[model samples]
Target: MAQNIIHLVNVSKNYNGTEALRNINLYIRKNEFLTLLGPSGCGKTTTLRIIGGFEAPDGGEVLFNGVNITSVPPYKRRVNTVFQKYALFPHLNVFENIAFGLKIKKMDKKLIAEKVHNILGLVNLSGFEQREIDSLSGGQQQRVAIARALVNEPEVLLLDEPLGALDLKLRQEMQIELKNMQQRLGITFVYVTHDQEEALSMSDTIVVMKEGSIQQIGSPIDIYNEPKNSFVADFIGESNIVSGIMLRDYLVKFAETTFECVDHGFKENEPVDVVIRPEDIQVVPAAESKLQGEVSAVTFKGVHYEMIVQNNSTRWKIQSTAMAPVGAKVGLQILPEAIHIMKKVTVK
Candidate 1:
């Protein structure tokens, strides 16, 4: 079993009396790529900061290697951060920028040069040693910032939306690069981002947050396919969420029709939330299906067309290769495996 490198025990934080984190209990395993995913004000960034020792929680403790370190300063912790704004020295070249930390420790010149070159090579910038910071592109500068943080060989790396400043194409490219880099380095990564696709693409485990609290934690596939509630289903991707009743194990009633589902564990006749992904819904001829809806909208989305079908007050978003014309009656076939039943959540 992999040992946990860090743990936040009942951690809570506040900013001017408003809660930033609410009793967040989290553990980061060694050498795993974990992402804290949520929207703004969700406290993903604040969680990362707490782990990096940049911010301290108002209650509870932070543990590093099983030892309490809640009060430790940022510089003393065995972690480093890479922020959205790649904080490189404007006057310094790439070499000087990466070497600043080692030099500040008063290390020998030859050793600093060796470490700087090696780190630059890891970041694929070996030949750009003398290039000025301003001379590099956004991607290159971000690489420099990452290299500087990684050069110190911290046990964990906290990234706060580091790719938010890059263009879409470059950001996607860096996603692959960063994942590969983390695998090659064999280090723990606690990344924070509001982008769901980015979190899904690069994470081994995802912690989804909402309103300063963690909503769910699981592997990306599990989070998407088996969301704990409607909030997770609606946030992780495009989902058709509807109120339903669990008629029995493997059976549910929604849209005035009963469906055979793969989920259970709910009380008999219990009200639940049904989550069906857009792609999981199969479109068929209305005459062949018991349930039918009228096509209200159709949108071409590259490989597939997104369709909105209206059945009374319920609007279903379905994705299919074939497009049904608006006003056409279509059948939505939700297979047993595609129907995900979740416990309904009540807000206080």
Candidate 2:
């Protein structure tokens, strides 16, 4: 079993009378790439700050390897942080930026050079050691920031949306690169980001946060396939969420139609939320479909078409390879395994 490297036990934080993080309980496994994922003001960054010792929590404890580190100063912790801004020195070359930490520690000159060269190679910046910070591109600067944090050889690395400043194409490329680097280093990574795709693509485990609380924590596939609530279903990916009722085991009613599903365990006739991924819904002939609808809109989305189908008063977003012309009557075929049910939540 994997050991827990970090834990937040009933951690809470407040700012100016408003709650920022409410009773957050989180565990990060050793050598795992974990992401704290949510939108702005959702307290994801606050949680990261708490872990990094930048901000002391108003309540609860921060634990590292079962030891309480709530009072430990940031400099004393075995962790390093890379922020959205690279914070590289404009006058320093890449080699100096990466070696700064080691130099501060008064390490031997030879060891600093070896460590700097090794990390530069890890971030694919081997020959760029002599390059000035301003000369590097946004992606390269971000890599330098990561390399600086990593060159210290911290046990855990905290990243606060390090790729937020990069362009889309560069950000995507860096996502894969960072994941590979984390695996190669075999160190714990606690990453914070609001981008759902970025979190889903790179994390070994994702902690979904909303309004100062955690909504769900699971593997990317588990979170996508079995969202615990409507918010999680809607936040992690494009989902067709609708009000429904559990009529019985493996049976549900939505859109005024009863359908067979693979989920069970809800009370009979319990009000619930139903989620169907856009890609799971297939477009079929009206006669063969489980439900009939009119194609309201169609968009080309590179790999597939993003289409909106209206059945009565309910609208569904679907991803399909087969395009249906707007205003055409169509049928939406939903498989039993594709229908997911969750207990309904009352919106404030």
Q: Report lDDT (Cα) of residue 37, candidate 1.
A: 92
Any runs in candidate 2 off by more than 4 Å, and if so which?
none
Provide TM-scores for the models: 0.94, 0.95
lDDT value for candidate 1? 0.90
Candidate 1 lDDT over 80-116, as tens digits, reads: 9997577889999999999888888899999989998
Kindly give the stretch of ten consecutive residues in candidate 1 with the minimal lDDT sum.
117-126
Query: What are the per-model C-alpha RMSD values against the true structure?
Result: 1.8, 1.6
lDDT of candidate 2 over 86-148, digit per residue (tens): 689899999999999999999999999999998998777899989999999888899899999
lDDT of each: 0.90, 0.92
